[model samples]
Target: MVHKEVADHIRSWRFIVLLALIVLTFITSMYVSLRNIKPAVSNISDPDHLFLYLKLLTTTDNTIPPFHVFISFLGPLLGISLGFDAINAEKNNGTLIRLMAQPVYRDNLLLSKFTGAMVIIATLFISLCLLMLGGGLLLTGVRIEPQELLRIATFIVFTIVYVSFWLALAILLSIQFKQAATSALTAIGVWLFFTVFYPIVVNLVIRAFLPDPSFLSRDEIAGYNEMILNILRVAPGQLYADATTTLLMPSVRSLGPLTMEQLAGAIPTPLPFKESLLIVWPQVSGLLAATVVCFAFSYYLFMRREIRS
Candidate 1:
């Protein structure tokens, strides 16, 4: 079942279009990164700027956003396209009824499709990373350090996890809505909400409660900033941006507000990989929890659903 689903996705027109967009983005962003890297590197005195390979992902030329930014926006759309019709379209075409009529268990059927989508996502990203690295090597003539490679690999894995949460949500919508179009639009609507409007809405709400710096003590102002940061982190986009940035750019020392005392003796150096992971563990955990919740809810709904034409 997983194999069949994988093959179908590869052959689907949606997959082909999304793949083109992703590759195009890769070319554009990397070209910009490679073209300007030398001058940018020469000018910047930041210690972490020594990670030239990482800059391939994090650098921007004031035209296109970097590779990571493209992924953050496109990743959810890819997941949604693959999953928004996973159940409903099959049902509309009578495939779900026919498949359920077989000896296969519903659990196996549903879970297999999810696994297939994930397999495709993982493969797509791993291949893209390798391709990007090869291109970076050719263009820059720089040897990738072991740690830089590991950080890129970690960033890819986090991206998969981040995207899977959207996939699960799309699947849940598919099961909820009978029409595939309805599911797809609803999923896209959710995506736009989080990606575009949710942050604005959250910020407006936070401003209502924002402590005035004039009245608040220094520690109190710091505490308010920390609280506001946590509120913003509730959006998956924020969580993903924070996590991926920490992974790709090692100079990010903290995910939240820190007091002057916390920064008093701190040196501006790239964090150890272990420390970087530790800093973003909460964001990682939040993403995983969201994925699990959405997938589990969809599984429950799917298991009890009555298959019909």
Candidate 2:
């Protein structure tokens, strides 16, 4: 019964539609990036600016492209939309009771739904990633470095966990909210709070606390900004961005911003990518763990909910 429910859920159009959108986004991003790229020019167009152009095309420069930003910002919205009605819709249609009448257990039903949704999510995420890689090869004809490919794969996996956080939140709300629309809206509102409104609120709080303009020195002001960001970094988006910078930019040792001269001085002597990964692994692990913790809480909430007949 559990397997059947998982299979039927995967066959649904909602899952298929998300898969299509993921592929479409992958193609669109690659096409636009390839189209916009300028041919490599040897003549110095501002020696300072030359590195920026090279970084854009290089594998390690993980600056969020259009495809990346879409996945980071909008992927969670899709997850929430798919899951917000997972429970409530069935209850509304009177199918909940009918399903319960079968020999299946409630734990099996809930577990199957969550597992199936995650399977579809992982499939869509990986498909989009591979599609982007193929498109990049066809358009630019550039061979992707193995390390770069691994970094991209890591980014995609992290993205799935990030989106799953919102999906879990939606499932938790669905258990609480009874009405599908209300559950969906609540999930979106929470998304907005984490993605948009929370940052604004944090800025406001910082500004209010540091009202005097000339009270702090340059170093003190930098310290204040760091403090604000540290507090706000509790959000998954911020954590992901921090982790991504470490993955994409080999020079990012500390989160502190440095001038070009300072950056040059601080560059590792041997510049081994493994060293870079070692430096950033803790940050990456933290973000992944936080994502799992959020979903685990949701699972606990879901299992405890009373689905009234």
Number of the top candidate by lDDT?
A: 1
Clashes of 1: 0
Deviating ranges (above 4 Å) for candidate 1: none
lDDT for each residue of candidate 1 in 159-267, tens digit (9 for 90 to 100) = 9999899999999999999999999999999889988988789779977877667997889888887887887787888899999999988989998778889999998
Worst 10 residues of 2 by lDDT: 46-55
Worst 10 residues of 1 by lDDT: 39-48
Candidate 2, which segments miss by more than 4 Å at Cα? 1-22, 38-65, 211-213, 258-264, 268-283
Overall local distance difference test of candidate 2: 0.67
Q: What is the lDDT of residue 136 in candidate 2?
A: 60
lDDT of 2 by residue, 136-177 (tens): 667656677766666666776777777777777777778778
Global fold similarity of model 1 (TM-score): 0.97
Error of 1 at 84 (Å): 0.4
State residue 184's C-alpha deviation in candidate 2, in Å: 0.3
